[model samples]
Target: MPNRCQRLLAAILLFAAPVHAETLLCHVTYGGETQDLEARPVSSPYTVPVQPIGSYFLFRIVFQKEPADLAAIKLYVFADRDSGPLPIQQATHPYPPLAGKGAGFGFTGLNQVYEPIRDGELQYWCEWSPSSGPAR
Candidate 1:
């Protein structure tokens, strides 16, 4: 039947389409305020931008999905200094994170990053979503 043939074709097309990159959502807290940062996969890790948090911290997230086998997600925390941003902490998680919904992946708990010089604290946690689109 033509209807059956059309359905088969549609299924094939769906499976053949490229996989959508996952989205990373990070909640960063500082100075009694919280900010949400969202990161999508990038071809080049160097292109990721640093986000300033309050007056003493900077944050960055890098998501990579290429080379399939080497895909990963990374989080960076920095101390905002007069000279420049200095790296304080780095966290990495493999692609297609095993930990499912709710539990989340990378830096799951209340992770506290400290700035040694000023004794400032930055708290953060991250979660991963299968896709950027709305739930089906």
Candidate 2:
């Protein structure tokens, strides 16, 4: 009893419904952080913060690759979590206030960090030859 056009349209729509299928995407990692890519590609590189330590000694961190999509940082010289801050701290034992003459607290080596690819919350990390800490 329906018109030809209406019947034809209904038949087309019924056949056009989407079929459900599950696909796995590659997992992504950066500076030691990982996230599931949901069968899709991530559009940006993950970033993390690195703090320098102690002015008493010069500190340096050599990234295997600058702005690496995901990399493993190597720590050379002064092994352990307590040698010296990456940038080297100047010993602010007496956290001097007001004047800039006090020792500046800092970390002293190479570290890895992973930022959460999530919304609303974030993650940060700091690795020092002498010490390490997690920041949220």
Candidate 3:
């Protein structure tokens, strides 16, 4: 009698956990190279690595979901001269079936990042850009 009740309670609790319906994959292209990373669903944004300030990079984002519902992804840009980085620009895009690409505007600074709303791993590298040279 008691064992039967315990089993039923355990089954109910297991099904009560929240589940994510989608997964986002982001790829940062910089210095003629590309980086593939996974994004997390959280409030705080994850900073991705590119070249130093004045350099240019591109982002390739892919959206995958089970039910194929409507969703959106936001990108946050931050920059700094000597002090810490500050938010400069923020842009959001609707998640497409395939993927999307984004680029940093022509600017100069340090610790420049393209942060996503979800969690993702960031990679940094040194490369040359036509718009601006590598950071000093």
Q: Give lDDT per model, in order.
A: 0.80, 0.28, 0.39
Which run of 10 residues does model 3 get worst, by summed lDDT?
127-136
State each candidate's clash count.
0, 18, 2
Candidate 3 per-residue C-alpha lDDT over 44-75 given as tens digits, one digit per residue, 9 for 90 to 100: 23343422322333332222222335344555
Give the alpha carbon lDDT tens digit for every residue of 1-136 in model 1: 5698899999999999877756788889898998988888898898899999988888998889987876888889988888988898998777866563344434355688888977778889887778673222
On the 0 to 100 scale, the lDDT of residue 97 in model 2 is 15
Candidates 1 and 3: which is better by TM-score?
1
Stretches off by above 4 angstroms in model 3 are 1-21, 43-72, 94-136
Model 2 clashes, total count: 18
RMSD of each: 6.0, 19.9, 13.9
- Evaluate model 1: give its lDDT: 0.80
TM-score per candidate, in order?
0.74, 0.20, 0.34
Q: What order do you get sorting by TM-score, best first? A: 1, 3, 2
Which residue pairs come into collision in candidate 3? Answer: 40-118, 40-119
lDDT of 2 by residue, 1-136 (tens): 9999999999999999754432222122343444332221122223322222221222222333333343333222211134533331221111111222213312222223222221112111222221122111
